[model samples]
Target: MPSYFSLLFKQDFSDLKAAGNSWEKLSRKMHDAFDTHRTKVTGPLHANWEGDDAKNALRFLEDIETRVQIVQTEAMAITKVIDTTRHRMEQAQKDLRAVVNDAEAQHFRIDDDGNVRLPKQWEEPQPDESDETRHERQTKEALLQDYQVAINRAVDEALRASGEGQKALAELDGEILDHKNKQMAAESARDADKVMDQLGLKGPKVPDDPKAAAEWWKGLDADQQREYATLYPGRIGAADGLPSDVRDDANRLSMEQELNALQRGDAYAVPGNDDRLHNLQTLKAELDKRDGAPESKQLYLLNHDAGGDGKAVIAMGNPDTADNVAVQVPGTSTTMDSTGGQLTRIGKLQDAAENADSSASTSTVYWLGYDAPEAPLMEAANTDVAGPGRAEDGAQPLRDFTHGLRASHEGERANLTVMGHSYGSTTVGAAASGGEGLDADNIAVVGSPGMTVDRAGQLNTDNVYFGQAPDDGIGWAQGLSLGRGPTHPDWGGTRFETDTSGHSGYWDDGSQSLANQGRIIAGQQPEEYVPPGQHNG
Candidate 1:
């Protein structure tokens, strides 16, 4: 019998296949039962019940249904993991067998017992060696070289497969353990601990004030931090006072949970089915694109939601450790479906920021953590999304997000800048005008509909920056419903030259606007904005 490592190229995963198939079937059954319980049992009980006893009975049934759903979801996640492992095992075996088959086809004998012997003709030449005989001899030598190359490649792949096979098994073991733990948890008594103080929960207290929030986060020990991150990932991840690195980790887990639920066709993804699918595909494509970029960049998925009015915040590079961090808030018509394009734009800013100052590391964030107004070009003529309604609703989240960044940041406080484009400027301005103060070193707005305010002084930041293109139609919205565009002199900010690429072209590559924005984020002087002759104006 071969050892497990030696059999890595030949091992079968029939057991995993059977397990996965069983789980897949179980998931389907559970889903059907859950639906039936809702329609046939829960609905009727709720409609007919009036007394306390009936209400208590309904609650018990509902709790059991929730537990069943959790099991079904985990079963599906585990099934995917098992299927991946099975495929990897099959491919590894095929690769090894291909090398053996090729060698045998070339007349190099490979016995079942693993012995390789050259043809006897090489040991004893023909009695009278003719030209044809010599040619045959050379051909045999060439085949031998081919055999050696094939075997070498096969061995390299086999080694890799051996290591990866073990790794996959280890991961599967962890998943299995987690599944069991979840089951046990469902059966056990529920803990009454609230996960975060902000939500009025009992676990850990986080203050509303930015500075106090930082101190509250510092008070938690490693065990307590882990507990909160595990129990209430959504709250801990989105909480303003948590550490960025911790928030990133917690948020990633939360994002994965929500994504898995969505992929299973959960109810939350029902309202905007087409939009939800588009958003998921776009999010995956963007993550894949970033993974392919040169050099390793860490991605922090700070927030994600697939329900009505989607929100997402993706950050490239570790914001907690970086010397400079820039957060970009997109404007009108920016939905989760367009996240890939938004991430690319942020990537450009990240690259530009690095080029601006090689000595400092920069983290660029694409913030879509609020419901942006829908202003599709076809509906632009009559859309209310272009107004300040969405901005007013989004302002508080932006303020909290910014304050959280400040609270959780490490080392010497980083130089933070919040950049808003188009209607996003309105949202940022609203947040700034609320008087809580955004705890940022600078605030920049470009091609703005308005900031919901007239003066830069109201923004609570000394280094307020503004940019605009003369031809951009957003200039017309100034002093109207959207307030005043930041570029307006009365806004009382440093106005800089931008590209002629219309309202949305400010962050395009090789453009003066991007270079200027990069300089400001990199903590460079205002005089350093755009190199000589880079701008049209």
Candidate 2:
């Protein structure tokens, strides 16, 4: 996974610069503190402590030292660079920012292509001259002396009419803007996060009934997860609830975070910023705030993944292109934040497909807008997810994802390909057989436990593809099984039998699996499949 985050900001770079400076300062302070702490430890005070208390303090101090060392080790870890060569590069960037700021001040845009365009709002409009006006213009032309006559002759009525037409077209361009705005609004939630909160479709659950909290925790909803998190710090933390509430410290630091994120128009973590620490604070804040309030109006958070950062992160891809599109649904231990920002995994897969098919114009999207439940039987017995147990959890989410794709993009897509990894294969199988609004041309599975269908024809999809690595421990352990138990047999599609990449990260590198997937998208039936990440290519 790539570590650097490309935070989009306005032309000024105000937020970027602020975030950079704050990180640099904080890192320096921590470094200084570490040096001082080490010095103190070197003195007699370091060995003064005894028993369990001393051991705990020593462990804490050791962890802090490791962190400081790790930050110093990575090139981009610290916000500031201390190397000799990079200082000049940093200064150059600051200079470039200054120039870009000046360019923005003018009514012009230096686009990604380096071309300049007139600001949309400031462009001149077309004139509308009626017949009477034209006749009055002709009369004025007749009254023209030598100089006026020369001018009128030089600019003919045809030219005048053409100029007016262009001006009118320019004004009509506003209509194009209006139409596009409506279309975007239709696809995207206008104030999505607020809607999600209103629905109580956020975070872990916080049970309404404190008395039935334990049972409610069993079938915990995202809302009740939050309530439990509020009550968590005192309780050793509930299994199906948000973690402890660090309100006293987190609340105080949250103001700084908001100031940097909202005002600066970027997500910024405070002094003690780490993904987990920041997310803990965010969960508390989300739980504390009232649902449906205007404050939680981040559209992306609502429609996409809103569970800040949790233990697991899952990535599902819906591929749609000219030839054949494929959708990949994943199971448990998958959500946006749980994956340590790795949940943005869909983007790389999209890039891979597009890169492979320059002629086909393939596209990929991640649909994460519904709740899928596990089977009652599966839920009763404890089973490790990512195994046969995963098949059970992935059942409903895959179906929901497929339905979301069909409903959201009807005419915009074509030639579907559905592939489910782990439990997602079952979800795909279920969706293809019958669902609210899901359609697929082909289906495939990789690193899967079992898909519930007998054959591709039975599921009503055009084709079905299946893949399992020769060395995949899970595949070898539970091959071709679809029974009620975790090691159930013969549930996957028969068509595809590939292991282009062993188990994970097929698209990341030049692997056989990714290559074959790309070929499927290109609508070709030629050579063997080549996974992008598997090979050095």
Candidate 3:
């Protein structure tokens, strides 16, 4: 009898044992591996065949193909890393959600030594409840009266920031508006001056203080005396015999001339010319304003780090609500921009998350800054993704992220949630595996190639959420092909890869996959609709 396990690599030993064991025993092992992330078999061998037998050639070729798949995924991961930044600037309802978002998520644990453990339980998010329901639960757990005191402090800061920003903008607006109005007045003054000069009444036209100026201008210096005398000769010449009509005309013209002169600013030029120039300036200013230069919109930026590869942004339009948050981490080819890119993707991802749930909060954040490599990520599905990024370069980055989550204050997660897409999810898993250091409640993983660890429980956070949008191509990239070599062996991610939408579908245009994302961004939990499609057709 041919033994089914007789012809494979040592790593395949568990598979052989399973083949020989009863279905129930094998199922138990599988369950343990699924929930606990502990497994006997990691994968088939990638080493060079020792034997010259031609039969080995078939398997060797298969392994090469697998490696190629891993490499091909590099392009997708690379794009994700570079564009996650430059997201919108909003204020997080930090105070409200802090109590729970940090600690309740269970991204951390307390070891006997009293140190925070990074990962003790994975974020096993159940897709059954809507974001609103999850938010209610999170809020109930986080927002106690005592926690409100602490939250008040954070809220004060946000309010202060918002207030100051508003004040600055208001002042600036006033200044700009005042300038514009002043320019308009100047232009009108110039026009009045022109009319006065045309009438040959170059004296004060419209005095700022009409009554006083009328009394004062009644008298004049040599030039004014001569000019006014000419304009109203009979009235002034015969001091006692002043004509009422001429006096009235002179008074009106004098006031108009005064106004025109003031508008011109320079008395040297005829009042008309000054008015024309002022008007031109006003016109030019209005035109400029009508174009793109109307007003410059300012941006707000925030980042927090826990010494290691943990990098993230704390921003929200409304975190107190059931908002959505996306924490993206890169595998290889990452840099500061990688952090930014993850955020930018979150912004683009808005459409996807919104599609998941129209009524959920849509606020989101991009969390980057892991110890992942700067470049040279895997290129194909068959390649070893864990070796370069997770096992080697990205280890610390992953640690810091999870640790930060654990450090999140517990019992005040009024509205704190997270979505880890692709390599970013792997990063989340790594943080959870640390045994202590994250405090997030709900976590979502989409298009993840691999998270390396054996179990989601090790990833820490309370609710472990996963999204694979059938269209996400990461399945082939993350999973292995049996004929190609081995099966796609994630610690517990096979369940997410239920469709063929490919790597990008997790956030495709208006895809319901991320509808709950908006909810999470608003500090709300994602809706639990496993087999997650409300409209996936």
Candidate 4:
């Protein structure tokens, strides 16, 4: 345990931080070495060699690769433990200094021995002290005692941080590397979690507001931020108001962990585990395809879940730096399994926006952050399809997500457009009409049943637009369940033209419907719809 005097005056974490940095660098080098060994050595050897000796040698090389990976993983775990320890100790020091400074500010003195002493004037009593003077002295004495207690508590925290760090470091078995342990990754993750618990590094309580969440994120130091992102990825990844890249890293880690656990049968007892595993695997494969893609084409996993009706939110480009951003909400039957199709639609949307205006950058997002209604059949009799309950339930999450995008964006604010398809339009409508609304510049809905509002004006946005295919039956659902459909003339929103004829065909390649949405997303006015025989062009 660290003593109060040593913690206050003699403790330094610079060496610990330097060691962590070194380990991080070494971990990277080890990973690179493994990659090189596989590519340059084993890859060619397997292609050319054919003897039994070659087979044996290849097996040994594979073992070498596994061992190297284990070492790299262990190194990373060590770095995390060191960084977490440094952060905890530094925080403890900060608390100690604050209380000491506060005590001294009030004319009290703290000695090198960690004792708080009152001012000399308070030490001696006045010969003819009045009742008021005596009472003042007693209050001062109590305050001094409180300061001492605070100082002691801060010291105790430092001692615990040091002890826990020591234990966490000890638990990371170096023998795992020598043995080529296949389970080293899981062990390392468990060790990191233990450190988080022991050091109280679970991070601060985050508020639901995106702006406030961003503020809280910005308040943490680099090390603290790393610990929170690595150790508590589920929370950090789902938190709104964090940078897109930060969320991307955290979510990718969390998804990988969940996938690994499920594959290992560690979570076999979880309900819907098989479906959840399939969804995550499909999502991971899609993201893996864009591993080395361009920034504009890169996929950022903003959020994901393996729970009931698993959720996923992904961006086609870096939302934080894009000039134009569009958030597309999906309707019925969307889940983690729909990742590929939904991502393709957003990619096409991004491409359309860029084609409409090549000079400006655009990022299109597929927001399945809400639990859209799902049922066994697409019949109108299904309550999930005809009812507005799910849409209403998703309102606040959608609002928070859009607000988070706005809060985390850099430079000038992006021209944000929120578009919903099918039942998703109802969710968008519900979100925009309730609370502070989505704060979006434009709201567009395609094949919308209703926006949960009688009029577009109730959505709190002036640039509302609606598109409905000629043969889409979803329009008939308007006013039957949710509010009046946005396509209704009395709804008071712009009616955009759509060349496609079905509810799901609005995004068909080269169609006017897709072009019109691209125009709206690019901050331009879409062409107005006209009756079949009314056009003079």
User: Model 3, range 201-251, lDDT digits (tens) per residue?
Assistant: 344342323233334444455334433432333223212112222232233
**Model 4, which residues run further than 4 Å from truth?**
1-14, 24-163, 174-184, 267-271, 376-378
Model 1, 161-199: lDDT tens per residue?
Answer: 445444433332213234334322222111111112212
| Cα error, candidate 1, residue 141 (Å) | 99
How many Å off is the CA of 499 in candidate 1?
2.9
Report the C-alpha lDDT of model 2 over 1-537, residue by residue, as the tens digit.
Answer: 221111111223355456545645554455455445543552223345677877677656644543442232121122222221133333434444444455467544544423334445434433676777666555433432322332233233323333433332232121212322322211111122222233233444434332243345446553233232221212213221111122221222222223223323233323433544455445423322211212111101212222333322122222211233445565434443333223334444445555666655444433332232233223423344323444444444455444433433324556666666555555565566654324566665666555554545556765656666555444532333442212233433443325454555545456666665555545543233345456534
Q: Arrange candidates by lDDT, highest first: which order?
A: 4, 1, 2, 3
- TM-score ranking of the models: 4, 1, 2, 3
Q: Per-model C-alpha lDDT, please?
A: 0.67, 0.39, 0.38, 0.82
Best by TM-score: 4
What is the clash tally of candidate 1?
2
Q: Top lDDT: which candidate number?
A: 4
Task: In model 1, state the lDDT of residue 208.
Answer: 64
What are the TM-scores, per candidate, against the unseen true structure? 0.59, 0.37, 0.34, 0.77
Tell me the spans in candidate 2 whose CA falls farther than 4 Å from its real position: 1-302, 305-325, 337-345, 367-381, 384-397, 410-413, 434-437, 476-501, 526-537
Provide C-alpha RMSD values for all models, in order. Answer: 22.0, 23.5, 41.9, 7.5
Give the winner by lDDT: 1 or 2: 1
In lDDT terms, how accurate is model 3? 0.38
